[model samples]
Target: MHDPIWQAEKKKILTRLSIAIYKMTDEQLISLLHLFKDLNLKDNDKLLEMPHSHADGVVAARDRQLLIARFFLLINQLSEADLLKFMNRYEQKRFSMLREYPRVPCNITLDLAADGRAINCSAMDISAGGMFVESCESFTMNQPVSICFSLAEDQLALKIKGRVIRLEQGGIGIQYESLTKYQIEIMKNMIDRLQRQASSQYRIG
Candidate 1:
């Protein structure tokens, strides 16, 4: 087991990432949970290619049930892109954002233009490709909607026109309009830097 201080720091970091982080879909969140569990099971700090043998049975026994429930809960709360971004960040812990840029979570206020209906929401996760936003308002699945938000540092304000791909309690899933080449470049750079830093630190420590 890691030392008390180390464990505390790890939990603290995870908690901070949870709150400040963007959204994640149910499928993505389950994958992340599995990743965390797998990382923890590594004895020498090297990530395992598969789950440990000892726990393999347990993992397989209830995999379907666990996935269905977990996925439902995540859909109720997180967004797809946010989910992907956080999973990437968690997988690349303790890296410099400059060398490894963390996915920037967007906090957006969505407005329904038809009647000026609006709600305050934020991403559960984000990537240059797309993002997931948690909403209090529910919409029919595959319904088209208008979205607006800024990228990191509020530098780039984007008004995207997209559709709701999935729907659940408290929110609906959206796939944003396609991103520009520049945005994709920025996201990839950030992810690469963070991943390298995480791997290096894990090796040294």
Candidate 2:
């Protein structure tokens, strides 16, 4: 089902983006063009302001990262709301390690087993390497555990072993020890579905 509210929000976001790009100074425009090359933005030939081009060349089909960089380069022209939005996004991206797989924020109920005991807990977020599980129970770093859960609308079952790598206030971070090929595929699919859901919610919100 197509969401009308999300469509409207997307339209508003594009409108704001167009207005913001239009107000960029020539110097800022040049800076963005260089940043585009630095980011290796895809289909970059489409970015050139050809002799007959009428638009600013920051069109819809451009890479999301490229668009984000342009926003940061032209932060002075954006409204307070838009500036804060892009700044926060950029700040978060900066903290992420370039070599690490980005974590997908989600809440998946699963059983966390440790030392022959299993407790139901919520998997707060997941990445290619591991997941952060929220529970009232305490866990020590390097504790071995197994996570069992269903995926693909509960059509398939999954169980994998991991080790607690970090202990936090309310939860523990578990890193996958030895993942099979099948486990990797299902995890990728789960992350893909989660990211799509998050994108829709972010647009509407």
Candidate 3:
């Protein structure tokens, strides 16, 4: 049994680490999560295989590697249950911070594929991180969904995967799966254009 005072301190540290992880860039966070998923706490050699960051400078990359190494070392000290608890806390922190991304209204029709079936839905709004689709179709929470849509007049279609995160009275919120750099850039450009258009319309009214 852990001492009461020690347990409190452990919880505090885990919370702080979770918050810090939440503040990392999406790519970094994704990499960290992947590493954790495949990690074997008993295998110290895995720590040496940490991926090097593509950060600009050598110093930056080295610093990031060191940080990740320390994080792994700390995890090695945790019991399986403690590690699970930490992961849960990290996920909670991540979802709570996702709404910080800017969202804009959109009206793009898209197809949602799940469980060997496809449902037609329209995007109500979108952000870099996720989108909300207006659909009467029922979807389970955390259900994996494949989304395919094209922007107006755009010949290229965007195919992305996401998970159902929230179910509203009339719609469902989808958080995108790990996006590639190109996908991230495309979403940012689209959001910028929509925001500018919205601003123009507001001024005209």
Candidate 4:
């Protein structure tokens, strides 16, 4: 029952899926894993009864197996560090206080626009939710600001709108507003790279 055409089509689907998965944020990937688990737990009769193009039970079962296999294969390809980071983030989301996401230490210079002027600032640390900017300029709480910065790794430019949530001696905490999925994905990737670099340096020392 080996069909070359079906195998070719499956390969194409998996290739596209891999690209999409790579671009997904950690939360999206975790959600997809949950979905795959639910699908795997479903009975064959239930799967066959579901709305799908395949009318034959055998084809439906084969498709389910292929789907699960492809997803796990991609998951398996992730490095041990990457997998550990994902799980750590998952646990942080469930139990961490104050901050909902983990922050990665960085020293990226950026432009901050507020009060009709652009001031140069440097980010001390960044998380998916926000960042702390080190600047001498005074910013009042809840003041709106626009930030533009490029990640060092890929030079990916990001312009984000945020508000000053906390004022400190030399810096202000900024909480990002209405972040798009794409922006979150880029931020997550940058954080992952920074974290991995930090870990390597720590071990070296």
**TM-score of each candidate?**
0.36, 0.51, 0.64, 0.53
| Candidate 4 per-residue lDDT over residues 1-205, each given as its tens digit | 2478655755565565565454333344445555434333333333223223232212243544454455656444444444445445544543552354589889999999999999988999999878999999988988999999988646767998888889999999998765566777778788888889999999999
Model 2 regions more than 4 Å off: 1-100
The stretch of ten residues in a row with the least summed lDDT in candidate 1 is: 48-57
State the C-alpha lDDT per candidate: 0.49, 0.65, 0.73, 0.67
Question: How many pairs in model 3 have backbone atoms within 3 A of each other, for residues 3 or more apart or on separate chains, i.e. clashes?
Answer: 0
TM-score of 1: 0.36
In candidate 1, how many Å is residue 12 off? 49
Per-residue lDDT tens digits of candidate 2, residues 1-205? 2478655765566567565444333333444445434444344455532222124423332343354454544543444454446545534543452234568998889988899887999999997668999988978888899998987564866898888889999999987754554566678787878889999999999
In terms of lDDT, model 4 sits at 0.67
Using lDDT, give the best candidate's number.
3
For model 2, name the residue pairs that clash.
none
- Residue 39, model 1: lDDT of 32
In model 3, the clashing pairs are none
Candidate 2 residue-wise lDDT at 112: 81
User: How well does candidate 2 score on lDDT at residue 194?
Assistant: 89
Measured by C-alpha RMSD in angstroms, how accurate is candidate 4? 16.6
Candidate 3 residue lDDT tens string, 126-167 = 998889999988889988999999876646889988888899
Q: Which 10 consecutive positions of candidate 3 have the poorest summed lDDT?
A: 52-61
